[model samples]
Target: MRKNLRVAAYAICVRDGHILLARSPADDGTPEWVLPGGGMEHGEHPHDTVVREVEEETGYRIEVTALLGVDSSRRTFPGRLLRRPADHHGVRLLYEGRIIGGDLRNEVNGSTDMAAWQDLDALAGLRRIRLVDAGLRLWRERPAEGRVQR
Candidate 1:
């Protein structure tokens, strides 16, 4: 099996006691909630990627405060249905950011449905998409060092 790795960054944007989140444009149109960000561009810094992605997704320019943590997940795609082996993995760096400016709006034709501030308490009851809890916990703890264990 051949191994393929990808790197991306996500922003944990917060303001006024609420957190900023995006509803991803899933294949089935069942958008799932996820942090605002995406894959890194070649030769681009991770910090820059997070900032750029957040702005692109949420229409809010932000300032990255610190690296929250790193997360990894693996999946398999059927080789018979494709050209190569199925094993795929991702290394994602999560960062904490504060909005600097820009009115909040969804990017045109982006992979996100909408952007909004969900109260911290609402998180407990709302059926959030994957990575919401993880991002919130990291923001709450705001660890000085080390990565958050999944």
Candidate 2:
């Protein structure tokens, strides 16, 4: 089996009862909505990573106001192409962000195809990655230990 670890940062930006989200293609090639974030670049601070990712995916410059919490998940699956079992662990730092500048525009030549603000109440039917719900939970729960229970 192969083991992998991934660390990323995500922003929970909300205003007027809407949340900022980016649309990306999921593993099965379905369009899935997720928090505006991605894997960190080596030598990049997590704060800087979130700022850069939000701007790249949503075209909105933001300042990370606070670290809301951390969400970690682990899963094992059979590799489709490698013919091996794999373990993947993901850690995401969820931050509260405020949009300071820039315009809303679709990302070009990026992992996410577009960005949009969705109604918080309307999320139930939308196809989304688990990060979306996890980030939102952290934002709302604001646990003292900076972690949310499954």
Identify the candidate with maximal lDDT: 2
- Model 1, C-alpha of 83: deviation from truth (Å): 3.7
Taking the tens digit of each residue's C-alpha lDDT, what string does model 2 give over 22-64? 9999889999999998899999999999999999999999988
Show the lowest summed lDDT stretch of 10 residues, model 1.
141-150
Q: What's the lDDT for all of these models?
A: 0.83, 0.93
TM-score of 1: 0.87
TM-score of 2: 0.96
Which stretches in model 1 have alpha-carbon errors above 4 Å? none
lDDT of 1: 0.83
Reference-based lDDT, residue 71, model 1: 75
